[model samples]
Target: MRDFLPADKARRERVLAVIRERYRAHGFDEIETPVMEEYSRLHAGLGGDNEKLSFSILKRGMNAEAIRAAADDPAALTDLGLRYDLTVPLARFYATNRAQLPTVFRAIQMAPVWRAERPQKGRYRQFMQCDIDIIGDASARAEAELMTASLDVLDALGLEGGSIRVNDRRVLDAMLDVFGFVVEERPGVLITIDKLDKIGPSGVVAELRDRGATTGAVDALAAYLDRPSSAPSFDEAGIRAALPTGIPDEVIAHLVALGETVAAARGADAPLVFDPFLVRGMGYYTGTIFELAHPSVDYSLGGGGRYDGMIGRFLGQDVPAVGFSIGFERIVDLLQDAADTGERSVVLVHDRDVPLSTLLALKTALIAQGVRVRVEQRAKNMKALLERSAADGYASFASVGVDTTAESLELRPLN
Candidate 1:
């Protein structure tokens, strides 16, 4: 949805390289999937609102009549859609390649996904997503590993105060049950709950009634929301005391263990916390969910959660999965443009009078010596050419003439 100039593009890649390296260090292997998938799969109610935002691809060989006739029944027209996120396609990929992969597959997907939604500041219809997922692990350890790995990535990027807000879909469900909400209405209720931070308790209650949520359920949740609050903590007693107390002891225990594990792994200054209200938008989430937060931004840096039932939609067998995705576009802007260039990166400024073969020879020699080389013909404004080369990440430059050997050139830093 946007174009990056050379310098901006390079900066983006630098961030991606760090993410890739850190995830690999955590034992996740990188993988790629197509940008499109079967429209049926994308619309299978797993993607939540993203299904509506998907860019559908029309079926091949359709005539005007076919298109017109199928306009109302879109399934008869479009057979594929650009993927809205990496997780769904990953499910298909794992199902197809599971036999060749490790029993517990840890995979990385750093690629662009497309949606048809309206774009806003830092939000685009087409954007890069950096995701790391672990499949076949159902324990709370899986969730802990994911949060720790993501926090480590934030640390590597020098984005301070990056913490994860953790919650469980089951906890949301339980909270709804305790409040006497209808099972059929809980999805819409969850959607409204996700907006609690944006809209206060009175607003949620009013909107729920407007949306026809059960009256009793609305009043019940409203009552809890109005209760005096002590801030939530990542610890067990704190979590119990934070939300409505009856949040299914099993879930509280699970979250406690998950937080403890990540704390032990990341030590003090670890940025993990419990937010009983943190309902990530994706409906496919079957258990724990995460939303990565940074102190400098109002929007989430990125998020993902457990999708234990998603793969079964493809493989016909359940595979436990949880993933963390960094909002690549959002995070890239937070990073300082990399000021350091590789010392071996060099630009060869040559006069037009220099023979092509001689210039080629000089460049070839530097590259053979492990230098990043570029050959630039001298321009009328020598200073501008040198400045541009520096911006393009060339560290030093040397002039070369027809008779110049690689050894005869003296490299000088542009600045």
Candidate 2:
């Protein structure tokens, strides 16, 4: 839905380059998937709310009219949709190609995804997701490695002042049980809770009540939200004690161990915190989930977690998988905000009397000598044209007069 100008494009490419190098160094191989995927697969209850926002493609060919006749029934008219994210399509790709791929696959996916939703400040209907995933690894080490690589990318981009909020689905399930929330109502409850940061506590309580949550459950949640930690690192013991006493020991152990391991892997001054209420909206996440948030922004930069059963739905057997995605658009916005707009490029200006061949020869020589050069006949007043070209990223200017020879091409730096 947007076109990137030259400076914007350059900034985006710079961030992507950093991501690619970091992913490669971590032993991940790049892969791409079609932007369009079958609508059935996308809406198979995998993508959560993203499924509702998918842009579906209408049926085409000889039966197009027949399909349109049933436009009232959208299912009959559409069979494909623009992919909403990179994860599900990745699941399908791995399911189809697992036999040929290595038993342990480290994959990289950097591409744009489409969603039919209202655009916000940093949220776009079309934006790129840079993901790094490991399939076939069931251990917490996979999660640790993903955290390490993702954090390294943030560091490389000089994106400081952020914290990684970590939590597990099992912990959420245990807490819901303690509050007497039924299994069927947990998803809806989580969805409402995920919006707590956007709409305040009052909004979530209203939505949960509307969804038929018991008054007692809402009261308990309100009491819990009253004491949010002021510091970035959350209190682990405080969080654990909030759950039921008989909750599975493995749940606590897994969270504690992953926290310790990821912190160690992240090295000195690691920024990891435990947030019991960090409920990611995606239904596909089966285990650990984390979100990256900056103190200055109300939104998350990006997040991902273990979708152990997502691939199983396709391959008929589970494949342990974990991933993390950096918010490509948000990062670009930050970089652009801090960018210097000064131009370092050169341009060649000529008049109608100047032969086209002469301008071409001059441009070719400058390019051969390793210069970023642009050539154009005079467009407007010389001063206005030069000023406009400078704003468009041209730093130096050259002019060819009637008596000027190729050997005497003089260059002058534009102020």
Q: Estimate, for each residue in 342-401, the C-alpha lDDT of model 2 and write its tens digit.
A: 434677888889877777777788788777788878776788988876655577888876
RMSD to truth, every model:
1.9, 3.1
What lDDT is obtained when candidate 2 is compared to the true structure? 0.82
Q: How big is the RMSD of model 2?
A: 3.1
Off by over 4 Å in 2: 62-65, 198-210, 226-244, 340-344, 351-358, 400-415
Deviation of model 2 at 87, angstroms: 1.1
lDDT tens digits, residues 362-401, model 1? 8888888999899988899998998898887778999888
Best by lDDT: 1
Candidate whose TM-score is highest: 1
Model 1 TM = 0.94
What are the per-model numbers of colliding residue pairs?
Answer: 0, 0
